[model samples]
Target: MRVLVAGATGVIGRQLCPALVAAGHDVVGLARSAPGADAGLAGVRIVVGDALDRSSIQRAVDEAAPDAVVNMLTAIPPEIDPKRLAEQFTLTNRLRTEGTRNLIAAAGGVERMIAQGLAYAYDPHGDGPANEDAPLWRKPPKPFVPVLAALRELEQSTRDAGGLVLRLGHVYGPGTIYAPDGSLLRQVRAGKMPLVSGGAATFSFSHTVDIASAVVAALDSDEAGVLNVVDDEPARMSEWLPFLARLIGAPQPKTAPAFLARLAVGSWGVAFMSQLRGADNTRAKNALDWKPRYASWRAGFATELGGLAAADAS
Candidate 1:
């Protein structure tokens, strides 16, 4: 199979491209910026193109002429400054929404298409282990509105194109927020991150390596629709955050005054800390014949954090 990975230089892309190549798929990666800036994506044929630019995307798609196309682009580590939220969300939204439009148009001939979506966007007013059929948050508080709106657009576009949407869990792995130099880890290390309110928000975490594998599996299948790519167990913020902090040798995060957090991180941070729902991966497991390498956060969290700590300390 010949695969084209857009955002192939992103956190997950850096891992996915190599996995695809190892699986015997010829891979072509789209990059708008400097080539090989990402550590693990060296062998992929790099095509320069910003996913938001229609012409650039078309050219990239034409160059690869892939049998399958995977839309894995995202603008993450978003600006922490509240003033920049709108603009940052809009830009990242384009990668997921408009960028997806361009890719679908460019990949009309491809047999399979796999797109990245968020599992965390579901309405938080529910029980744990929500399935794909659950209702997405319609009135996401202020800052998240643009992001969720874009997510809706992206999903609609992919569904219309008969593409598969991988509504991935909050990704945590080598190149993700749990990485030694990642923003979240730095915040945790510095005691800037905190558990807002009770910290009972359910978190659905997916390892990057597992997500990369799922992307490959999605491409290999003819099944079209949405699947939540997450682990077996969903963790509550209170349970996971402190455990993660302990593993990283960081002081336990202090509980932020909920109102202050709302003012600072905005409603977005509050929702993550107090309200989000965790996704169920039963569909992906049964349909794609896939299971996460780390079924529980407990199994992998310590090892993952320990390695990053060792590297950072060294």
Candidate 2:
């Protein structure tokens, strides 16, 4: 299969493009700038294109002439301030909504399509693990409402285009926030990442590699719908934060009262740490015949947790 991957130089995209090549698919990587040497896109072809520009996307798609197109466009920042979480995704929101529409329009003839979505946006009214059917948070902190709207637009349009939406969990792996040198790690090390109201919010995590594999499986399959691409264990902030701190030898996470936390991290941050829901991967597993390699974040973190210690020793 000839596959064109937008955002092909990004975190998951860097890994996904290589995986597609390894799977014997002809892969074309779409990036606004020339892919740097570190992109490691040895066997793949790179096309320069701006995702939000419909004409540019059309030109790239025309040049690549792919049988399938994988839309991985996002502009999430290196470090997210929970206080201004929605603001951080301003460009990402555009990419998800506008960029997605561009890709679908450009991919007029290509039938096989898959786009990245988020598994962490479910409404907090219900139980722990939300499935594809669960409604998105009906109302959120005012700023976050647009973020949800963009995703809803992305999902609806992708499905309408007969594409599969892989709603991923909190992405973590070598190059992500969980990475040793990443800003989130630094925040934890500095004792700035506090637990909100005992940190009851559930979090579903997805490793970069695991998310890539799920995409590959989705590309191989013929069906189209929503699937929560997460690991087997849906964990809570209370459970994972301390474990991570210990793993990195960071100071124990401090607990913040609801009102105080809201003052510090804003209503969104407080709710994120206290009321956000996790997602279930059962449907992705059964539908795509896919399962995450790191079935639990515990095992995944254990292997990669030493970077801080190693950095300290160095």
Candidate 3:
């Protein structure tokens, strides 16, 4: 298989490109510059392309002439302010809605097409973790409306193109918010992150290594539609926050009232911390014949972040 990967220099791309190569696929990675920056992607042929530009995307796709196309484009900032998540996600929204259309046009001849999606967008009114078929948030906060709309557009377009949408869980592992030096860890250490309104929202986490493995499996399969690629465990914020703090030797997080929390992280953040729903990965595991290496954040945090914290201290 000749696979063309957009956003090849990103955290997931850096991991996915090499995995595809190791699986005996000829990989062509789209980059913003030639001779891509990541040395980890040794075998992937790099081609400069602008995902948002129609002409540039067509040229790159033609140059690569790949058998499959993977859309991994994103523009998330490192230090996120939950209050401004919708504003912060503006570029990422474009990439999903606009850039996705450009790539789909360029990849018309490709045998397989896959794009990233979010698993956590399901309505919070559900009783348990959401399956892929669950209703998405109908009335998201004003800030999240655009983001949710973009996600819907992205998923619809990909399905129309007969492509698979991997609705991934909250991603962790190296170069991610769960990483030793990432923004989330910094906040946790600084006591800036708190348990908002008892943090009732449930979170389903996926490590980068597991996410890459799932992408590889998706490429090898003929299945199409959406699948939630998450770990086996779904933990609440209240359950995970204190555990993470204790594991990383950080101060116990304080609980903030909903109104007070809103002033800091906005309504969207309050909902995220208190009302968000976790996703069910049963379909993905059954379809892709895959399972995450770290099936629970409890174990993942103990081994990954805990070890890293120990190393940094030593």
Candidate 4:
């Protein structure tokens, strides 16, 4: 299969392109600039194009002539401003909605289209992890409304184009917030992040490597609609945060009142960190015939942080 990947230099794309190549797919990567394109994408043909520009994307797709197109485009900032976190989702929202439409237009002849979706958009309800059929947050908090709306638009457009949507969990790995050098890690080390109350919000995490493999599986899959790409474990923030801090050799996180947390991180952020629902990956695993290498964040975080510790020691 020939695959064209937008946002090919992004955190997930950087891992995915190479994985696709290894899986015997000819890959073309859409990059905005020459330097933005990673030289490490050994066999991937890099096409210079901005996803926001329909003409550029169309030209790149024409040149690539791919059988499938993967929309991995995002514009999330490396460090989110706590007071202005809502602002951070603005450009990414555009990418999810407008950027996705442009990509679909560019991939006119492509038969298979796989898009990125968020597992976090599900309404925080039910007794267990949310599945694909669970309702999206109808009335999401203000900061998350646009983001969720864009995600819904993206998924709807993809499905309308006969594509598959992977509702991925909170991604954490190298180049992501869980990384030793990532923003979240820095906050943990600096004691800036705290658990709100008992931190009961449940989260499903996905390692980048696992997510890349899932993308590869989805590439050839005939499965349509949404599939949650998350780990086997669904843990509460209190369970994961202290564990993560221990793995990274940081002090145990302090607890803040919900009001204090809302004041510090905004209502959306507080809700996201302390009240979001977790997603189940059973459908994806069965449909894609895939299993995550890192089954749980317990093992994943330890190994990832352990690697960093070893590197630093060396």
Candidate 5:
């Protein structure tokens, strides 16, 4: 099987490409820059193209001529210029909404397509762990309206195209927001990260490797539609934040009042930092026969932090 991975140099893509190759599939990695930009991608056939640019995307896909197309493109990170920040929603929305369009269009002969979505955007109904069938909140009270609206568009776009939408959990890995030396970790180490009042928000987190594996599984499966690609246990903030601090040997976060958190982090951040909602991956496991390699957040969290600690000691 020949596989085309757009955004092939992304955190998840970085792992997915190698996994696909190791599984005996020919892998083509598409990125915005030259092939050598990705360090561990030595043997991968790299094509340079910006997914936002439909022509470039089409050309890359046409050249790869893969049996399946994996749309892994997402633009988010340290590039925080005010203008870019303003376009953050637009850029990523286009990547999900429009970029997927171009990839599917270009994959004229491809059998399957795997696209990205967010599991957290589901309507926060009364719940311990929400499954794939849970209702999505297109408009929340205030701050979430715009964000959820964009997410809704992304999901709808993929659904309309009949592509597999993997509503990925919050990605934290080597090149992501929680990278060993990244902002979140730095905050924790510096004691800048504080726990919200109650600190009971449950977050469903998935390891980058697990996410990559799920993508690999999607390519070979006939099943399609939305699936939650997340860990078995979604840890509450009270549990995970302090646990993360302990793992990093950092000071435990100070418990701030929920009102203060709402004021400091805004209503949106407060909801995310203090709510309880976890996505269930039973559908993926049952249908695709895919169980996450990192079954629990405890395992994944330890792995990430342990790796970081080792790197620091070295």
Candidate 6:
């Protein structure tokens, strides 16, 4: 299959383009500039285009003439301000809605279309992990409502066009926020990121490698619905935070009161780190016949941190 990938130099796309090539698919990556076309995307062809611009996207799609199009476009800032973290995703939200529409529109005659979605948007209702059938938060916290609304629009557009939606969990790996030089790592090292109360909120995590593999699976399969592309283990902040800190040689994070946290990081940050529910990947595993290589963040973190350490030593 011939695949056109938008955001081809992004965290996920950087890894995905190569994976798709290795899996025997003809891949064309869309980049807006020379820097956006990273050297890592050596095997795949690169097309210059802006996903937000309909004309650029159309021209790129026409050039690629792909059988499928994967929308991996995002504009998340590397360093998130605690006070304005909720607003940081405003551009990414736009990418999901407008950028997605542009990609779909440009993907004329394409059979398969896959767009990204977040697993953390489900309402915190039950103790168990939420599945694809679970309801989204109808009334999310004020700051998060726009994010969820944009995600809903992205999913709706893709599904309406008979495309697949991969609702990925909190991604952590070499190029992600959990990496050695990433924002979360910096916060953990500074002791700024903390557990609110007992940190009971659950979070499902996926390694970027696994995320790429899942995309490959989705592209190969005919499954055309929302699939939660997460790992096997579902963990709470209380469990994951201290462990991560220890792994990275950081001081144990201090526990803050919910009110203090709300004042520091805002209500949305508090909810994200303390109240978000985990997602189940059963549907994705069964439907796409896929299983994550790093089944838990424990293994994923060790590999990522170890690699970072090795690189530093070299």
Model 2: per-residue Cα lDDT over 55-141, one tens digit each: 998898899999999999999888888778778989999999999999899889796999999898899899669999999898987
133-204 per-residue lDDT for model 3 (tens digits): 899998988889999999999999999999999998888877888888899999999999889989898999
The global C-alpha lDDT for each of the candidates, from Candidate 1 onward, is: 0.84, 0.90, 0.90, 0.88, 0.77, 0.87
Q: TM-score, each model?
A: 0.94, 0.97, 0.97, 0.96, 0.91, 0.95
The alpha-carbon deviation from the true structure for residue 10 of candidate 1, after best TM-score superposition, in angstroms, is 0.9
Q: Give lDDT: candidate 4, residue 169.
A: 89
| Model 6 lDDT tens row, 9-117 | 8899988988999999999988887543336887888888888889988888899899999988899888776568567988999899998998888885588999889
Colliding pairs, model 5: none
Name the regions of candidate 5 deviating beyond 4 angstroms: 78-87, 141-143, 307-314
* lDDT preference between candidates 1 and 5, better one: 1
Q: What clash pairs does model 1 have?
A: none
Candidate order (lDDT): 3, 2, 4, 6, 1, 5
Predicted candidate 1 versus true structure: per-residue lDDT over 1-314, tens digit per residue:
88998888888898899999999899998888756453577668888887888998888788888998899888876225443566667778878888899889988977888899999889988876789999999678788888888888988998888899999888887767676667788888899888888797898998888998898788778878899999898988989989888887788999877898887777777777888889999999988888888898777786577665566568
How badly does each model clash, as a count of residue pairs?
Answer: 0, 0, 0, 0, 0, 0
Candidate 4 residue pairs in clash (backbone atoms < 3 Å): none
lDDT of 4 by residue, 229-307 (tens): 9999999999999888777777799988889888778878788777889999999999999999999989899888976
Model 3 spans with C-alpha error above 4 angstroms: 35-39, 312-314
Per-residue CA lDDT of candidate 5, range 23-94, in tens?
888989888887565368866898787777789888887788888878777777643322233345566766
When summed lDDT is taken over every stretch of 10 residues in candidate 6, the lowest stretch is: 305-314
- Worst lDDT run of 10 residues, candidate 4, spans 33-42
What C-alpha lDDT does candidate 4 achieve relative to the native structure?
Answer: 0.88
Query: What is the number of residue pairs that collide in model 3?
Result: 0
- Model 1 scores what on Cα lDDT? 0.84
